[model samples]
Structure formats: structure tokens, C-alpha cells
Target: MKQAIAQYNEAERLARQEKFREARPLLEAAAKSGYGRAWYALGNWSIHGIGCRKNYRQAFECLRKAVRYGAGREALFDLAICYETGKGTSKNVRQAARCYIESMQAGDPEAISEVARIHYWGIGVKPDHSKARRFYLRAARRGDLESAYLLAEMYLTGEGGTTNRRSAIDWLKRAVDSDDAKLAWDAKERLKQISAVTM
Candidate 1:
């Protein structure tokens, strides 16, 4: 057990230094010993072909094992993405939503944003603006700029309930300060339009 952990640790160290090739064998060793993180790492590597051939089947298997062994939030989130995009498995929107929900339950804030998206778009699940609003609010409060931007739109359009220009403006202002250039630009543009209309 200790040896497996050591292998996983060393693999992580090597991967951080961009030595994926060197880390692969160690990760494989740890994964074979039932290390969840190692399985997660191997899954990601298989998906992206970092140090091995890109094999969706292999990626799916590794990710499944990782999740079974209690992988971290990222692995769960990635698994959700896989289900959503058919990366290593058949595209299954319902399964994707389930994985996203699981990821959220696993404490992945990003999954909150994804859940909001699905609700807002009626993807695989019934469209529920109220649910989307709730998820967006949660993610935004957790400092997710994209969620804040989406929340601002919801406020502006009254997607879930009554329109609140003030709330929209506040969220836009917060988005404007984001480091993401595209989001900041959109926020600035929206703020301008809002000001023009109000003025």
C-alpha cells in the first residue's frame, strides 16, 4: 500500500514537471494497486494521449475505476464531460446530467455551473429556469465569473422570475472586473446598453 502511494506521489511530481512519459509507468503501477488518483491520472492521460495513445475505451475504463475508488472532484467532473460529449462513451445527456450532479455533490464548484447550463438549456433534463437560477446563484457566489455573467443575464431577462435591473447591473459590474477578456468585454457592452436604455 505504501509503495503504491509512493508511486502515485512520484508520478504526480513527474507530471507536474511535464514529464508525462516518465510518470506513466509509475501511475500505471499505482493504478494497478487500486490507487484512485493514479487511475484518474491514467484516465486523463489516455483521453489526451499525453504519454500514451488516445484510447477512449481505456480512458472510460480508467475513469470508471477512479470514480469507483473515490477519485477527486476533477475526475468526476471529467467523467461528466465524457458522458456529455461522448468522448470515451456514447453520448448520454441524462447520464451526463447525473454525473454533473454527482460531481456537484462531490464538492466540484464547476459542476454547479454545468448543472445550471443543463437546466437553463433544457438539455437532457426538463428546462427549469428556477433551478438554473438557483445553480447559477450558487456558483456565482462561489466566485465563478461565468456563472456571475449568466446570472446577470437571467436577472436582465427575468428568466426565472421578475426582472431585477439592479441585480443585473450588480452582476454585470462584477463580471466586468473579471480577468477573462471576453467576459469583461461582454459585461462592458451589456452595461453600456443597459445604461443607454435607462438614460
Candidate 2:
């Protein structure tokens, strides 16, 4: 484990120095030794061609290996993105949704937000406005700005059910206080638009 850690550190240093060619072998060695972080880093570098050629296949392989080692929610999130975008595998919205759910279960805030997104947009699963709202609320509670905005939107529009102006305003204020200025602005606008409506 110490040797693996040393090699991983060396790989990270090499990557930082723009020596991707030198980093790959070390990263691979560390990753093969059960260093999930190294696998994740290698996946990122390979996917973006950061000092290395863009190879979705290679990136996918790295991420998958990390997943096998119980990497983290981020790896699950990335894999979900890849599946959704058909980077290394066929575009499979169902698979993507499952991945997002798994990531969320692993406590990934972004995955919670993504689950809300797909639920709202009816991307892979059937349109369930209540489910979408629930997901948004879950993510928002976890400090996800996007989910906070989405929850506010749902409240203001009453898309899933009757509108709740009070909840909308409250969540908007929370969003603002959370320092998500973009979401705060959107929530404010939505509040304004729904101010006249009554239950």
C-alpha cells in the first residue's frame, strides 16, 4: 500500500507538471494496486485528453475499475454521464438513471440533482412530477444549488400539483443564502411570476 501510494503521488505530480506520458504508467500501476483515486484521475485525464489522447474507452475502463474498488459517488456520476452521452457505451437513459440513483444512494449531491433533472424532463423514466419534486427537495436539502432552484421552480409553477407560494419563497430565500446567486435570481423571478396566484 505504501508503494502504491508513492506511485500514485508521483503520478499526480507528473500530471501537474504536464508530464502525462510519464504519469500513465505510474497511475496504472497504482490503480492496479487498488488505488481508486488513481483510477479516477487517470479516467479524468484520459477523457479530457489532458496531457494524453482523449480515449473514452480507456477512460471508461479506468472508471469501471475504480467502481469495482468502491471508489466514490463521483465515479458513479462520471459513469452515469458517460452512459447518458454514449461516450464509451451506447446511449442508455435507463442505465444513466440507475447510475444517478446509485450515486445519490452513495451520497453524491450532483447525482441527486441529476435524478431530479431526468425525472422532471422524463428523460429515461416516466414523467412523475411528484418524484421529480421529491428528488429536487432531497438534493436541495443536501446543499445542491441546482436542486434548490428546481424545487423552487416546481413550487412556483405547480407543475406536479398545486402551487405552494410560501414554500417557493422560503426555498428561494434559502437558495440566496446558500450563495447560489444564479439560482437565487431564478427563484426570485419565479416567485414574482407566481405572486399573484392563490391556492
Q: Name the candidate that leads on lDDT.
A: 1
lDDT tens digits by residue: candidate 2, 1-71: 78888999998888789888898899889988998888888888888988788999888888888888768
Off by over 4 Å in 1: none
- Report the lDDT tens digits of candidate 1 across residue range 156-190: 99999889999999989999989999999999999
* Global lDDT scores for all candidate models: 0.91, 0.83
Assess every candidate by TM-score: 0.95, 0.84
Backbone clash pairs in model 1 (N, Cα, C under 3 Å; residues 3+ apart or in different chains), count: 0
lDDT of 1 at 195: 94
